[model samples]
Target: MMFEENPPSSYLTRAAHSEDSQETITAVSHVLQDQENTRPVPADNSKSFAASGDLPAKPISPQQRLARLRLLMSRQKAEYESKIASLEQRHRELQWEIRDTHWQLGQQRQRHRLAEMRIRDAERAKEDAERRNEMLQKEMEEFFETFGEINRWK
Candidate 1:
């Protein structure tokens, strides 16, 4: 009686509402055989429940669920912030270590260059000392040549 009393506004919803009843399907089949026309109204979905998630399923509404799911794979809120901060700190430490290593490398290279120059200077000094010793030895031999004649005469 209530179904007969009130018909829904939309034709699609009205037809869909009718299809919920066995008598309506029979009537619709007979009407189709006789070549009749009918319109349906949108169905009420207040009592329906979604198969997944806490949100209701709609024709084209996903922004709400998507926003909630954006951080689904991420760490918890404050924990992620702390993790990022810690990672950045470690990166800064690594950068400082790299800088220190480069500086030490530069210092070692300078020492090597200076040592090479000193070695060359030392070689030259040693050669000059050897040359002076030979010149002194020849002068001493000339001085002893006169003494040898005096000793032979005595």
Candidate 2:
């Protein structure tokens, strides 16, 4: 009677004004369905709705709820900030360790190269010494042969 000949607009206004009995029933049913689908928020006790904190177990005013939500958000933000700081510190440490490792590896490789060069030089010197010894032995044999010939003539 109030919305004579304007059924759709009347339904929309009723839904908006929270006046329709059918809309209220549907809303309540949907809420129940959602509750059935959801896992319970961990409560201190089965009867209490509060989590494991000092917050109220029963429903509070809207202002108190808003304050609690803000506190939870701030706590989460602080935790994220702490985690990021720790990760950054660890990143810097790892970078320094990598650089140190690289430097040490380079020095070790240089020392190894120098040792190889020294070994090559020592091997060459040994070969030269062996060749000189062979040449001296040949000279000594020739001298002895010539001395024997000279003594025979004498």
| C-alpha lDDT values of all predictions | 0.57, 0.65
lDDT of 2 at 46: 50
lDDT of 2 by residue, 1-154 (tens): 1222332333334556786667844543443344334546654475563444554545444455335435644665687788899999999999999999999999999999999999999999999999999999999999999999999999
Give the worst 10-residue stretch by lDDT in candidate 2. Answer: 1-10
In candidate 1 the C-alpha lDDT for residue 128 amounts to: 99
Please, what are the lDDT tens digits per residue for candidate 1 over residues 28-141?
Answer: 444332321233422643444333223433432234322332342133445667888999999999999999999999999999999999999999999999999999988888
For model 1, state the Cα shift of residue 111 in Å: 2.3
Q: By TM-score, how accurate is candidate 2?
A: 0.58
lDDT of 1 at 117: 100
- TM-score for each of the candidates: 0.45, 0.58
